[model samples]
Target: TELQSAQRKAAWADVARRIAHEIKNPLTPIQLSAERLKRKYLKQIDTDPETFATCTDTIVRQVEDIRRMVNEFSDFARMPNPVLAREDLRGLVSAALVLQRTAFPTIIFTAELPEDPVIVQCDGGQIGRALTNLLKNAVEAIEARKGNDLPPGRITTHIVRTEQHTTAHITDNGKGLPVENRDRLTEPYMTTRVKGTGLGLAIVKKIMEDHGGALVLEDAAGEGARASLVFAQGNGRAGA
Candidate 1:
């Protein structure tokens, strides 16, 4: 079954590569045409100016959405192998946290990193990206929880090191994990949310695998989800 799944994913990735290559060529021209049309004729339209503006705006918006999807397809189809090296894992986590905190100022962010650096043999950029994506997902999940009675959104992060593994946990207080098909979230094109290319977790999983590690998804203590990036420690593979 795993073999079948892997084959299916390979086939889909080939299709994605072709689709991205073909679709991206026209998106820029289409967007530019729509913008030009709007800029040149917004006020000259005699019949209904508002309707003309709305139509052009819709065209531009939809084209941008398609461009985003195409980029995701490209990213998924051509994920590069991790460039592993020795680096401070805590610094990577802190960088990711700083980015997410700046992006989502309303969400309270907290970190529990140790005073000393936790060094590991891994791709610092890829690890930072994985952390950033998880943090972004957590923020989006909190934003999606629509209610007047809900408390302020919060995200917690921690980097822990043991004899066997060095792990980073990103926990959020938002919508909890889905009861069904939780494990499938890491599969390519699988998603719980309506928006997104559904490749965030999949890419993260690939990055971890490249480093001989794992990406673990689970529920938080009370609410929301926790994504753990675990790198092997003292195995002549990952940690120092």
Candidate 2:
């Protein structure tokens, strides 16, 4: 059964690679065409310059969005093996929070890291990306509840190390996951946000798997969502 599951995952990875390659081939041309249209027609339409500019701007923006989606697909399809090394997990978490704090000024971000380094053999870049994605999703959830009479948004990151595993918990005081389809949140193209491509969580899951880790989701104690990245403890065992 485990072998079959592995085969299924490999098959899906191959499919993702092929699909991402085919979809990415034409994005460059489309993006260029949109940019050219904006540049060539911005001043040509003298009668209604505002309307012309708005239309071309919309085209450019939408093309950029498509390009971003394509890149995410490519990242998922071509995820590499983690280059493991002993590193400080606290610094990685702090770095991710710093970037998110700049992006979301209104949200209160906090971290609880041990004074002594919690060393883990991991690909720092990939793990950092996962952290950033989790933070981004938390911010988006909070933003989704705008206009409601709610308290200030808060996101907390806490790291726990045990004898057998290390876990990083990211909790947010925002909208929690839906009870019905929560299990499918990491599947591709499953998103609740209008503008989301739904690949963020999927990519994070892949990265965790690549590192012999797991990505877990749950509802926070009172409200909002909590995501955990769990890594197994071993005697310097490298992930395949």
Candidate 3:
């Protein structure tokens, strides 16, 4: 157990260091060049000022977006080891749903929490982050659906505890997983969206793995996506 943990930590640290180095290298130059062009061309341009401004603004905005994504890479690479404790799984799911509701008001959000607590040994913070990422992905998937007659987006969270494992399922009424390479969705840098960095699902998968669990993504019934985070029922104490 100790050796596996150490290996995992080392792998992540190396990934973080490499990503930070690679991405941060060109960002500064890109930012500075955009600023320089804006300053030098703003007054000297004989053409429309608005066009120049828009171009410069676009470059600046994209740069910032990439910078934000780099930060996410750093966060994932340097993710802390989860501090395991007995925590209420229902409460955790509730907190995630509440935040997502506020963040995406148009989307209908629902939860199916048991009357009794579904307790689990987990790192609440890490699990919470994983939940948030999954919820965010669901929202994005709904937004990406193309058509005028599509139904209103809906997301549901449910928890199921069995004798050997506890599972939290997040289902969304959105465009489901792609038919090709669906299993690779959790791999790093794999994304369906034009603007997505593709690290969110990868991070969630790593978190689940670190907790001695797994992340499963599937196409919901006829449409939409379903993501399940499965945790082993260590000692069978969860939900007791």
Best candidate (score: TM-score): 1
- Cα deviation of 228, candidate 2, in Å: 0.6
In terms of lDDT, which candidate is strongest? 3
Per-residue lDDT over 63-150 for candidate 2, one digit per residue giving the tens place of the 0 to 100 score? 7777778777777766778888886889899999999999889999999999888788889999999999899999999888756579
Off by over 4 Å in 1: 1-19, 235-240
- Models 1 onward score TM values of 0.83, 0.80, 0.78
Candidate 1: tens digits of C-alpha lDDT, residues 1-240: 999998887888888898898998998899899899999999799999999899999999999988877876687687767777788888898889888888889899999999987888888888888898789889988998977989999999998888889999999998877788887888888887776788888989998999889999898988898989998886334333
> Considering only N, C-alpha and C atoms within 3 Å, which residue pairs clash in candidate 2?
none
Whichever of 2 and 3 has more TM-score, that candidate is 2
- Give per-residue CA lDDT, model 3, range 1-240, as digits (tens): 999999988897987879787987898899889889999989988879889989988988898888878876886787778888888889889899989999899999999888998878888998998999999999999998999988999999999888888999999999888888787988889988887888999999999998889999988887899999999886227453
Question: lDDT score of model 2?
Answer: 0.86
Error of 3 at 173 (Å): 1.0
Global lDDT of each candidate = 0.86, 0.86, 0.88
Pitting candidate 1 against candidate 3, the one with the higher TM-score is 1
RMSD of each candidate?
3.6, 3.8, 4.3
